[model samples]
Target: MFVLSVLLLIAAVVLFLVGRGKERSASGWKLGAALSAVAGLLAGLFACVHVVSAYEVGVPVAFGKVGSPLTSGVHFKSPFTDVTSFSTRPVDLNLNDDDVVEVRSSQGGVLYADVTIKWAVVPAKAVGLYRLAGSEEAVEERLVLPDSREIIRNVFAKHTSEEGYASAREQIGSEIADLVKERLAPRGIDVTFVNLRNVRPSKKLQEQIDKKIQQEQATERATEASRTATAEAERKRIEAEGVARANKIIERSLSDKVLYNQCLEAYKEAAKAHPVYAVPCGTDSNGTPVIVDGSKSG
Candidate 1:
């Protein structure tokens, strides 16, 4: 740890105190003085040596003054400084974990969702970031969390509960990423991707939407049934009219002579089958005889 150098310095001070309280010529006094010198030297050397990992950059601070960012690998610095580490790689700030945010929609319906924002330290502006926020975690607390939460809430508020869970979900995430990027970019943080996932509306609102959908479906079924019944009734009416028209045509064409001829033909067919005779039963309007079966005449 970087603080190991500070501990060494304190030990050196302790050794120096022990030597001061002893007799100048004493062996114990000489031993304390030598140990004090060795401790001080070691402290200085350890403080100057900083080991930064591949994913991290170190910012050196000395006597309340901040210096330039030190990139990965071993760096030599002054003995009076402290180093703060920040990652150059992408960092995930998960709003779904401990940072869950609950938002109210435009229609005052409650919504909950999972959100993730990916960001990274801008290398060129690391010194400025270190000056503004003491550490990476401090940057999140002071900058990332507050801005992101507010942006998300504001964006979601522009949509209704139904839109929040469905239509406007993707748009909300995109607005968050853009706005957060605008705010953090000036302060050395690069916002990458924003993910919106698992958006859920409150139970009451969901039930309302479900009920409305069901009612619409029922109405559609009723309308289709009505149309089917009307079409069937019209088809039957049209068929009845056609049959009546055909019967009227046959009535208009028939005459008394045709009827008398039809009866005579029927009588002759009966006589051939049995010993039945044909007789004149009546006269038509044209003075034609109406044939009848003689055996059945009473």
Candidate 2:
């Protein structure tokens, strides 16, 4: 558009020179000159207009100097200025195993985190972004990716290796998101959220973790066995005490008359089987029964 406007203006200048301010032919040339000049100025005006899209904010730059941002609509600027549009849409910057972030836990154990951060350049801050980082790619390189990776590492560093690997992973992600947002807001990056996934200990750290887990499992099994044995011993003790109590109760309940009846019943049963008769003998001082089994003479 700038080139077109310049060409039109040149045409107007050539027509005005051809008129030379003279006769009928000159007068006609002069009219043509006036029309061409007007058309040129209109073209120049058209060249100044910039259309910013709904999801974009444009910053005008002329000869290395940055201008105020243009919002989502038509705006006019110096025809010499070029508008650079920055997207305000959320974009994913996934740092998977391909870009794993190395973190040292508080316990000095090493691990890696696979992170995905959703972020966008703030529309109102687009001018600042232009001043700081020129392109969207530059913003990620200089501000977004590096800053987020460092924040993730720092947040994970505050926890033990286990927390980074599994235990407090969600909490670590939240912390990372908060820190990245806080750190990059002034730099014109709006971090929506940080997702930490596929986190695990480093190779050496993993071997150590596996060993620790195996030891814990063994200790648990031993403790359970000990508990079971103690319970069994307690149950046997209770059973023996019950049996002893039962015997004592039976001994206390028996009297001399009870013993004598039991003996008599036994003798009667024997007589039933062998025709024997039970003959009572005098009891001793303790008064237990004495009985003799006599066979019936046939």
Candidate 3:
């Protein structure tokens, strides 16, 4: 557009000069000159005016050299210079199953991860970014993607497959984001956030982890059962000891006189229940009691 405007302006100048020199065809030349001038003015206005959206920053290029950055809103530049706009808003780059990254674990097991990186070009560095990286797509392709993959691989290599799938997943992502930020900040890209959406170990590794967990649970249960059985045996032993102690106290209280009195009371109770009865008067040979009926003794 700028080139066409310059061409139209040149044509108008040529026509105006020719009109002034001619006497008979001067009005025709003047009319053509006026039209050309109007066209050139509109084109020049169009080329010089630029609107940078709220989310975008513009970089102006003069001839072949890159110029300063332009913030959001209307801006004016030379019609000869071109302004290129790039979004300053956060952009999400997802690397999922479709673009899964394979990495090795500390234990030499393979792991796959799905990740996302949220980033944007630094607004102040728009012109420098354009000069260095060309475009947003180019920045992602040349810098973001390769750097993210490399950082992830390096971080994952420091962890085991179980760690990748479990406790260390988030930490791994954070480390990647930090490293990538350090690597790209000097180049005008800002790494805002990184997410390790999913990490999966190989099928064999997963099965082994599951088995190990089951074995640990079983061992815990067995330990608990052993503790319970030992407590029960201790309780039974204490109860038996108490019963034996009570028996010993009772046996120590008994005497020969108490036993003779008890035997006499039993014989008296039996005599009241029967006219003729046998009773134990005393102990005879072999410690056996000798009983005689009252009628047989008479």
Between candidates 1 and 2, the one scoring higher on TM-score is 2
lDDT tens digits, residue span 28-126, model 1: 765665675576667668768999899888888899888888889999887778889999899888888556788889989888878888888887788
What Cα-based lDDT does every candidate model obtain? 0.81, 0.85, 0.86
Give the candidates in order of TM-score, highest first.
2, 1, 3
Model 3, range 1-298, lDDT digits (tens) per residue? 8889889999999999999999799999998999999999999998999888998998888889888888999998888887888888888999987788888899988888999899999999887778767888888888889988998999999988878889887788788888988998988888888888888887877788889899999999999999999999999999999999999998998887787778788877877876546456576556445555675645
Clash counts for the predictions, in order: 0, 0, 0
All candidates' TM-scores? 0.74, 0.76, 0.72
Model 2 ranges with Cα > 4 A deviation: 1-47, 248-258, 281-298
lDDT of 2 by residue, 1-298 (tens): 8888888888888888988956668878888888888888888998899899999999999888888888899998888999999999998898976788888999999998888888998988999988888888888888898888888878887999988888888888888888889999987889887788678778999899999999999999999999999999999999999999999999999987787778777877876888555675338786544544455343
Runs in model 1 lying further than 4 Å from the true structure: 1-40, 253-298
Best by TM-score: 2
lDDT value, residue 226 of candidate 1: 100
Extract clashing residue pairs from model 3.
none
